[model samples]
Target: MIVDSHCHLNYGSMTEDMDGVMQRAREAGVGTMLAINARLSEYDEVLAIANAHDNVWCTVGSHPHEAEKEPGITAEQLIELAKPEKVVGIGESGLDYFYEHAPRDLQKANFLAHIAASRETGLPLVVHARDADEDTAVIMKEEMDRGAYPAVIHCFTASRALAEACLDMGCYISISGIVTFKSATDLQETVKIIPRDRLLIETDAPYLAPVPKRGKPNEPSYVKYTAEFLSHLLDWDYDDLARTTTDNFFTLFSKTRRP
Candidate 1:
């Protein structure tokens, strides 16, 4: 069985026909999913998506883009909010310089709060690092010095240096549907270097649909396409790849049940 390590089920597009979406995922052999909460105000909705389904779990934190608006949020607040049994992770956080939607300082502050939450609770941090690789790597390294915490660089398309930085810190790396694209040559090449045990796969659904299904609204089922391609790309059998990633997922997010 495979796991879609990250997704956004509470998002409107995917929620409109949630049952059908999940049905497709099961048919595609996806056994579990982690619904991501990018905004603190949306915690209940995101967690509800997980609570309502046996195969789903969730994270509690804010995205970098929303950082400025939530600058006052604290690690204590996040730690308390993450008290639920199914809240298996502490973020969708980190720096996003490409968009610059949120001020860098605010994003850094919010990221530290989530990192503190992860360090405190021992839950994995679901990070979203983009063009800010230097700072991302720097901050991650600095944070590790403060205290190590489990984390994964989700939807990774960053430089190899950043990838190495994450792995060096014992953090996992999650590849998304973006890897299936013809233009993601750099990412596909970067995928080759990720240690088998440190790798995870996700769809980041209703956003990045893999090829053959590219241009269509993404869903959990589409993760198989990315995984299938990755298996071939890495010269490993599909089952072996699935087992490795699934094992990595539960190991990283230890709070999840092995269904």
Candidate 2:
């Protein structure tokens, strides 16, 4: 079975037909999903979804876009919020220079807070980095100097340099449907170099749906297309790719049990 390591179940059309979304996912062989949290204010909603679905788990923290609004969010606060059994990770956080929705300083501060919470709790940090790889790498390296923590770079589309940095830091890299695009040659090349054991896959649903489903709203079921694309890209069997990525998911998010 495949695992959608990152998604927002509380967002978009999926929320309108929760049962259909999950049923389709099951039909497509998706057995597990992580409902990511983007803001502390929405943590309860995110947790509720995870709580309601035995196969679904969640994280606790703010996204870089919501950094300014949750300016005072602390490592302690994230740690406290993560007490729920269903809250299996800490973040969807990091730098997002591409959008710059929040000030860089504020984003960095919030990102560090998340790192600290991850460090303290041993929950994996669901890092969201875009066009800010250098700072993301530096900050993570600096934080690692203090203490080690598990992490995964979700929806990764960064440069080879950043990929190497994250892999060197012992963090997992999650590939999204972006790699299936013909225009994603660079990303595809990068994927070829990622060690199988360190690789993970996500749909980032209600967002980057893979080709064929490109124009339609994305959902967990569509993650199969990504697995199929990667299987051909990596010259591995589809079943192997699915099992490998699913195993990697549970390894990083150790707090979660396979459904």
Candidate 3:
């Protein structure tokens, strides 16, 4: 069975037809899903979705895009909110220089708070890194020196140097459908060298649907396409790729139970 390690089930299209979405995911061999919370304000909706589905789990924390909204959000607040059994990870948070929706300083401060919560709670930090690899790497390394915390770089599309740096720090790299694009040759090559045990796959659904599903609204079930592409790219059996990524998901998000 496959696991869509990151998705936004609370968003419009999927939320309106959650039952249908869950059914489709099951039919697609998706055994479990991690419903990511991109904003603290939406935690209830995200958590409710997870609470309603036994195979679904959620995370707590703001995205870099929403950093300015919650710049003062502290690790203590995140730790308190994450006490819920359904909340399995922290922060789809990190630097997103590509969009720059939030100020860089605010984003960094917010990212560090999420890191602290992850360290304290021992939950994997679901990181969203884009075009800020240097600062992201430096912050991660600095924090790792303070105390070790589990993390996964979700939807990674940075340089090979960043991938290698993250891997060196024992962090897992999650590839999205972006790796299947023709223009992503660099990312594709980087993905090939990622250790199997440290590799993961996500749809980041409602966004980045893989080829064939490209340009359409993405969903958790579409993660299979990303997995299928990787099986070919990495030259592993399809089932084996599914199993490896699913195992890696549970390993990093240890708070979630295998369904």
RMSD of each: 0.7, 0.6, 0.7
List, residue by residue over 144-188, the lDDT tens digit for candidate 2: 989999999999999999999999999999999999998999999
Per-residue lDDT of candidate 3, residues 137-212 (tens digit): 9999999999999999999999899999899989999999998888899998999889999999999999998998
Candidate 1 C-alpha lDDT tens digits along 1-259: 9999999898757889998998999999999999999999999999888889999999999999999877877999999999988899998999999999999999999999999999999999999998999999999899989998999999999999899889999999999999999999999999999999999999998888998899898999999999999988999999999999999999999999998
Pairs in clash, predicted candidate 3: none
Question: Per-prediction TM-score, please?
Answer: 0.99, 0.99, 0.99
Candidate 3 lDDT: 0.93
Error of 3 at 11 (Å): 0.9
Clashing pairs in 2: none
lDDT of each: 0.93, 0.95, 0.93
| Candidate 1 vs candidate 2, lDDT winner | 2
Q: Tell me how far the alpha carbon of residue 175 in candidate 1 is from the true structure, in angstroms, after superposition.
A: 0.3
